[model samples]
Each structure stands twice: as structure tokens, then as C-alpha cells.
Target: MGVRLRTAMLAAALLVAGFALRAPFDQLRRYLIARCNDPVRLPRLAEESRVRFQPGARDCAARVAEMLPAALARIEQEQGRPFANPPTVAVYVSYEDYARAGGLGDASVAAVARSGYVLLSPTLCGDESERLAGVLAHELSHSHIFGWRRSWFAARPPSWFTEGLAVMVSGGGGAEGVDEAMAVRAMARGWAITIEDTGLWRDFGAIGFAAEPPPEIFGGDRFAGRQRLAYREAQMFVAWLRRIDPQGFARLLNRVENNESFKDSFVKIYGAGSSRRWSEFLAGVSR
Candidate 1:
């Protein structure tokens, strides 16, 4: 074979290897750091439930333990189903350890639902217990979907639906910085992110915030400003659907859990296309 062809083949192989190894690499790093953690068990959580933090972070851990049951209950109550297999919760005592986990791009995130874990930052756990509970519920909502689908190969839901549902079911956990009234006003003025169809790589975080939120929203925190606005907008959309047709919202969750096409499921449950539903939601919020 030509030298050039051999080099091309080698590059392709390396690319594939990198893609396969990235997840395991990050998990291993997180596991190593967790070795020093002190575990806090909650019998009310799922079978594999693990909540742990560094030795000196007991106060934060205790607060998490106290709020955990209520958090899990809130998601189950709102979604009408229990977690198939809840993700383990890992608490970091500081931002340094949280950033070393490697998957998330932004360090401002209070907590994130990973493939099989929820990593919490110190800032989140240090906040008021109520806020911690809300954030915990929001992350668990993602974990519920992760487990119910059973595998990463299952149908990928759109970011709008996933994050929107999380914020809605968690009672505005991720959208705390952006209120419903403000989000509605922004949507009415045509400053909203486009609701796109589900695709493998269509995460909102990856896409970045397209909607221009007001300059004064989160003060100097651009990340929080844009992120919370998108989250609030999506939450409003989902909340509207839930209020308009409770049965349909329930069916939507069922279909989503079963790895069904989201767009098709919306149409089947709502008796109209997703586009129509979007228009209806916008009209109601605007009025």
C-alpha cells in the first residue's frame, strides 16, 4: 500500500479509538477521585444508589441526603413513573474536583446527570437546602430517561424536550434565574431558540444559546444568563403542554420512555403535529 494511504488508515483508526475511549477515560478519572470519598447511604434511593463526598464535606453530604428522598419523590410524582435505575450521586467539595470529571464544558453548572452518575458542585450543595433539592430533582429527571431507555443507542430526544421536561418536572430548578413571565415576554417578542427535531448530536449545550436574552438578566454571568433563558423558554413550552392536556403529557412520557420518536409521539398524543403544538403554546403564552 502507498505510504499516504497507510497514514490515512492510521489516522482513521486513531479517531475511532479516541471516540471509544473518551467516556471510559473520564469515568476512570472520576472513580479515582471518588476513592477518597465518604459514602452516605439512602435506603429510599434505588438499589445502586450511591452518594459520596470528600471527608470534610459531610455537611454538604448530609444536606443532600436529607433532600434526596423528596427530590426523587418529586420526579416520580410528576412523571408518573419510578426510575428504572437511578444514577449514583457524586458530590464534589470544590470546583476543582468537579472540573476534573472531563465531560462538561462549563464549570458554572451546579450539577450534571452523566451516563450513570450525577456530579454535584460545591456551589450547589452550599446553597440553600431547597435549591439543592430542586437541582437534585432536575438531574435525576435526566437519569430517569437514561435508565428507562436502557442504552445510549436508544432514541435520542431533542434537547428542548429533555431540558424543558427536566425544568418543568423539577419545578423550575434549572430555570431559577429566568422567570416564567420574562421567558414568556421574550418568546412573545420572537427571542426564542428554535425547537428542532431530535438528532444524535443535537444537544443545546453543544449548539450554544441562539436566542438573545436581555443584557441585564444574570448580570455578568453570561453562561447562566443564556442557559437559564433557554431553559426557561423550554420549560414554559413543556408546562403549557402539561396544563392543556394532562393525559397527553403522561402519554408523551410513556412514549419517550419506550424509545419512541418524539415528534411522532407528540403528534399521536396531542392530536396534532409538534409544529402546531408549538404555535399553540406560543399563542397562549403570548396572550
Candidate 2:
């Protein structure tokens, strides 16, 4: 064949391949955009959410309030108890202040004062107000589960379990879909990391906090990877437990919150004492 003809054929083939790839790419883009734009789905609260928005916080507290009842109901049903008190949600726009307060990303931070106030960052509030409500509902679950104890030691929820439970309760149980997808992707890529090694749950004293620089204290690549893994694994494990035994999982969470040992919790809930069950569950899902 002539060189000109050959080059033209090659270009034509490349164009066709590009066109073929476009459909999936577009689909993915649309999916992500939709997810981003969707309202934050939060679990309903027993009481109405009193959201106080900071400047430029995008006033959506009323919308968030409307969505809280359903989310709270789910948690109440799962735990078989009402929240100890009404929740006060505050939305902020300052990343610096949030970091100073020891927050990650745009997160719902529960107070240690037992006041039931949750600090939420606008960036993490999601595209619509509903999405923010969902995030708040998740945070509220942590608050309810832990009471006034802000210490990680107090919660002692396995990284996966706490996060998974939060995801499960948030958005009336639909947020689990996103949680599962992120988790399965992490598991398939062998990126899942144990939370113990990361020391993310460790409590830092005032002196210790002052001694370490902010950058040194907060952002480590290894730690970040592990944190991501923890969130993913927690979601996956929660989903697995729900699938295996919904009632048992709920009972197990309540038991654990009441200071049950991990082994005891597992035994009571799953009728097994070995971590092997978890490993098997992961392996099965990864397949």
C-alpha cells in the first residue's frame, strides 16, 4: 500500500477507537456529576436539626432539617433507642479553622462536650443541601453511639465498623452504595491497610500537639492511604455484616457501644471467634 494511504488508514482507525471510548467516558462523567449534584442524604434525627451556617456556607439548614427525621429513625430502629438529646449542627467554610480543630476533609465533627453540636464544613456539604444532611446524619450516628466521649478509645469501634455503620445509617441506607464501591475498589487493588499501624486513632495531648508541626502532624502519604483504606474497609465490612445478618449486626453495634470486647462482640453477633471470618468475607467480595 502507498505510505499516504497507510497513514490515512491508521488515522481513521485511531479516530474510530477514540469515538468508541467516548461513550463510557461520558457515562462515567455523567454518573460522577449526578452523584456530586445529588442532595446529601442523611439519617433522620429524633429532633429537628438546628443548623447555623457560617458566612458563605450556602444556606441549606432548613432543607437539611427536613431530611433528618428519617435518618434518625433508622438509627433509632437499628439501636433500639432514642438519641440522648437534640443535635445542633453548625456549617463552616474555613478550612484553616477546621484543621485547627483536628478535622479531615469537609467532615461532620461531633463535640466532646455532650452538647450534641456537630461541626460541618461547607466544602464537604455536597452539591445540594440534602447531601449535607446525609453527612450530618452520619456524624450524628457517631455522636449517638459514643455519647459525650470524643476519644477514639471511648468509641473503640474498629475503623471499618464505625465508618461502615455511619455510612449505613446515613441517607436512609442508600449511602452504602457509594461506600461499598469505594471499598471494593480499594480491596480489589490490594490497597486496604490496617488501621492500627496508622495511629490515626491515637489521642494527641496539648503538649504533644504543640511539639509537632501542623504539616508533620497531619498529612503523611502512608497515613492518608491507610485512612482511605480504613474508611473503605469499614464500609465494606458493614455492608458484609448487613448482608450476612442485619439484626445481628445492629445488635453487635449496640453491644460494642456498651463496652463489649471485639471478640465477644463478634462471637455474640456472628457465632464465631476468629478474624478468619472477616478475611473470608473480604476474599469473597474481592472475587
Candidate 3:
């Protein structure tokens, strides 16, 4: 009985250690994949430009290398700060490889931002050069946010702000299929993305969200069309906020990047809760 107990305890200890060490292990795995899988590093375009691509995808890699400087500069200009560190971009010719290398989000997503690197999908490398730039800029925006904030801060913002701000910065990359007119029509029909200044713990961990609309209504699957509409509405709302108060928008971005309370900073900057601001946005859309 004593030997059995010791064996069980040892097993449990090893299991716990694995769980504790998984993040760093996974991070290392991703870095290796980024470095090894994409063997061809393109010509240097800027101090921060380190783009890697597979041989089959050299043409796309060249495009990325060409556009990266302007894209990074544009994102920095819009976000009001420089990237804390240069992002290493890995462009893949296969969706399977991209997924294996820590790409999150649905397959339709063009690019995904990791902590210090980016994974670009094959579709974005095609003839859609315009879309390629937008998607690149969008992911870079996420990279900028990751630079300054804690890991948990990534999930702290309401999805609206996170996706919407990226959409706005990229000039409609994520919400490409839907436009302002279509989003307004959906809002008029009672389908709209909810705007909330989420608390630090709202969507973190296993805690259930306070009874809110369904996820599909918020950011749904690609086939349902709800996701695109939600993204578009979110972008429009963010744009409205900036247009109504440019200085206030800048201050809000500063506060958010500095790890301030999103809810408090928003109210302080705009003089009202998100609900009120949302209503004003709706009114403006109606007009």
C-alpha cells in the first residue's frame, strides 16, 4: 500500500509540473516552428523587417517584404506608439503548416498574431495584394498591443474593441465582406454587436459571463454572416467614437495601452458609459 501510494503521488507531481511548464514549452515549440519550417528569409527591408517564407511562397514573401515597412509605419501612426520590439513574420504556403505553428482563429482568418511573431495564411499571399496589406496591418496591431500589456490584458477588452480597433486600423480587413451600410441595416433590423467595457475578469477563466447575448450574435461562425456583421458594426462604432472626439480617442488609446481600467478610463474620457455612447452611435447611424 505504501509503494502504491508513492507511485501515485509521483505521477501526480509530474503531471502538475507538465501543466506548469506547458506555456514556455509551447512558446519554444512555436519559435522553432517559425524558424525551421520557413527556411527562406527574405531581403531586409527595414530594421525590424525579418520575413521568412517557404520556397514555394517566395513571391508572397517578396510582397510582404516590400509592404512591411509601410504597413508597420502605418500601424504605429494609427496606434500612437512604436512597436516595443520588432515582429518576426513567418509566411506559410500551407494552411496545415500555419495551424501547426500556433495560428489561432478560424481558417478564414488571413493572419494571426503571436507574442513575438506572426503566421500568415496562404490565401493572403495570392493576387489580393490589397487585402494582404490590410491583413498584415491588422495582425501587426495585435502585436503592438501584446508588447506592452500583460497576457491577461489581451482578453480583458470587450471583443468589440479588440476586433473593431484592429478592423479600424486595417481599414476594414477583418470585416471586409460587410460595410457600414450593411451594418446599419442589420442594426435597424435588431441584430447588432453589443458594446461593453468588460471588466478584467469578465471573460477570463471559467467564470460565466453575466447573462448576455449569445456568442453567435456577438461574433459568429463564418457561414452565419453574423460574425462579419458584428465586426463591421464594431468597426463603425469605433470609428464613430474617434470621429466624435479625436483627442478623446487618443487619450483612450493611451489609457488602454498603459494598463488602466478600461471601464473607468472610457467613462472618464468620454463622460458616459459604453451603453450611452452606443446609443449615440445608433442615433448617428439612424440619421
Model 3, CA-based lDDT? 0.72
Residue 166, candidate 3: alpha-carbon lDDT: 83
Which pairs of residues collide in model 1? none
In candidate 3, which residue ranges exceed 4 Å CA deviation?
1-49, 103-106, 127-130, 151-155, 199-221
The stretch of ten residues in a row with the least summed lDDT in candidate 3 is 201-210
- Writing each residue's lDDT as its tens digit, candidate 1 over 1-287 gives 99999999999999999988887786565655544432333222322236766656666767777777788888888888888876577777667667655245345778877656777777876664457877888899988876788655666878888888999988888878689888777777778766765744323343234466667756898777778888888887888888889988999988898888888888788888766788778777677
| Position 40, candidate 3: lDDT | 38
lDDT for model 2, please: 0.53
Clashing residue pairs in all predictions, respectively, total 0, 16, 0
List CA RMSD, all candidates.
5.1, 17.6, 6.2
Candidate 2, 192: how far from true, in Å?
2.8
Q: Candidates sorted by TM-score, descending order? A: 1, 3, 2
lDDT of 2 by residue, 116-140 (tens): 5565655555433445655667777
In model 3, the number of clashes is 0
Flag regions of model 2 displaced more than 4 Å. Answer: 1-49, 55-58, 100-115, 125-130, 148-155, 171-182, 195-229
Write down the worst ten-residue block by lDDT for model 2: 204-213
Query: Which of candidates 1 and 3 is the stronger one according to lDDT?
Result: 1
Best by TM-score: 1
Worst 10 residues of 1 by lDDT: 38-47
